[model samples]
Target chain A: DAGVTQSPTHLIKTRGQHVTLRCSPISGHKSVSWYQQVLGQGPQFIFQYYEKEERGRGNFPDRFSARQFPNYSSELNVNALLLGDSALYLCASSLVSGDGYTFGSGTRLTVV
Target chain B: AQKVTQAQTEISVVEKEDVTLDCVYETRDTTYYLFWYKQPPSGELVFLIRRNSFDEQNEISGRYSWNFQKSTSSFNFTITASQVVDSAVYFCALSAPIYNQGGKLIFGQGTELSVKP
Candidate 1:
């Protein structure tokens, strides 16, 4: 049985550039949420998608957006990246119950 | 609005010692859920436990235990006979009513635990 999976374990981008992070939830899971973990801090909510529709969004700027595909995979896109955007991006998926969330190892983004 | 606070920024204890991580949460929803996660240096959040607001019982699982107090709005985690393997960042999180909010998880700043052998 596979857990949640994320792609490009590490990434580097220049300021004002754009980046896309990918995540594939476990089979049979429909809810996927994204989080950003800055160094020395906890993971902050970004966006959540369930059944191909966005159900919630965090306080991030419009430069950050995400969408869930029909297959339940998700992509988090950040535009005009800044140095502050460098962090570990995490993806979590859960069953309909939604409380028991399983998180991926996360993609470490470094914007210079 | 939902928020979680972990006052202890860092804690150090010798192996076999006992330690407790405190978590304070604020939420308006009458019923919600609390969770504990352990993240090692490798940087992955490992789920530890989950408790709903309706259940205030203290739970024990081997060397780990949790105390949930609704009156105090606290969900505390204690590790007994701690080991070096416990060295990591522990996070306390809160989730609003799952169905209504799509299970947005609000996390605390996290407490870094250092278990010296």
Candidate 2:
């Protein structure tokens, strides 16, 4: 079976610019969550969507937003990007609230 | 706010040696979930294990084992007979009760493991 998939494995953007990352969950999965991983750090949760609705959000600022489409694919949008926004963006999918999660390889974003 | 601490920033051990990664968590809520994930050089996050608050049983899976201690608020992972393939960054994470505010996950800084031949 296919695992979580993300698009544009690498990206580059400039300050004040906007970027959008994409993710497609594994087949039959209903929950999708986004995470940011800086160099030498663990992945930090950004947003989680379940059943096509927002279920959770992390400590990220309002400049970061995400939405899940009817097909269960997800997009994470960052506005006015800062150098600090450069990191690996990960997408994870799980079956339910307490089940194990499967993560995508992630999009490596570099904002100059 | 919930937080997880992994004091061991980096660890190195010869192949076949044993090593343990420590994780300490702080949360005011009584019910929570803990997890450990491994990220290999390929940058894919792999789920190692997950432990709920009520389950304190130590679990052993092949060469990987988890020691969950509620007293110290810690969930440590130990690898026996480590291999070069075991080199990766390990992350400890916490998830609040599903009904608490929102089911967000709080993560630790992570520990980088290097296994040598």
Candidate 3:
């Protein structure tokens, strides 16, 4: 079975622009979570959705938002992007909230 | 607040040598989970192992092994007879059920392991 998949593996955007990153969770997985990883740093949690409902959110600002569809696919939207927002956005899928997660290759967003 | 610490920023070892990566965590919750992930140059976080608070048993899978110690609050990973394939950035993470955070994972800074042939 295919693992979690992300689209637009790489992207470049200007500051103050908006961008959307997409993720398709593994088949039979119900939970999807988002994380942001800065260069030379580990990933930081962003948001998590289960059964199309927001279950958890990290310390990110209001500019960052995410939603999960009934099929368990997810999209992370970032508005008013700042140069600090440039990082690797990763998507992970899990069977349950506390279970092990399977991660995607991640979308690399570069804000210039 | 929960925190995971990976003191070693990077380590290098020759082929067939053994290497151990250290991880220390802090959490007030009595129940929680610990995890180890490997991010290769390709940039995908691969799940390696997960251990819970109740089980402290050391586990070994092929050439990989993990030591979870509650007394020291450490979960260390070791690679036996390491190979170039094992070179990657290894991360240690912790998760606990917080009021608004649910069980979101808090990751450490990660340890970059370089295996030389």
Q: RMSD of each candidate?
A: 1.0, 1.4, 1.0
Q: Is candidate 2 or candidate 3 better by DockQ?
A: 3
Candidate 2 lDDT, tens digit per residue, A1-112?
Answer: 9999999899999999999999999998888989999998877888888888888888799999999999899999999999999999999888864356789999999999
Clashing residue pairs, backbone N/CA/C < 3 A, model 2: none
Candidate 3 lDDT by residue in tens digits, B1-117: 789999999999999999999999999988888999999988999999989899999999999999999999999999999999999999999987745465789999999999999
lDDT of each: 0.93, 0.90, 0.94
Worst 10 residues of 1 chain A by lDDT: A92-101
Residue B88, candidate 2: how far off, in angstroms? Answer: 0.7
lDDT ranking of the models: 3, 1, 2
DockQ of each: 0.74, 0.65, 0.75
In CAPRI terms, model 3 is classed as medium
DockQ order of candidates, best first?
Answer: 3, 1, 2
The candidate that wins on DockQ is 3
Give the candidates in order of TM-score, highest first. 3, 1, 2
lDDT of 2: 0.90
User: How many clashes (backbone atoms < 3 Å, residues ≥3 apart in a chain or on different chains) does model 2 have?
Assistant: 0
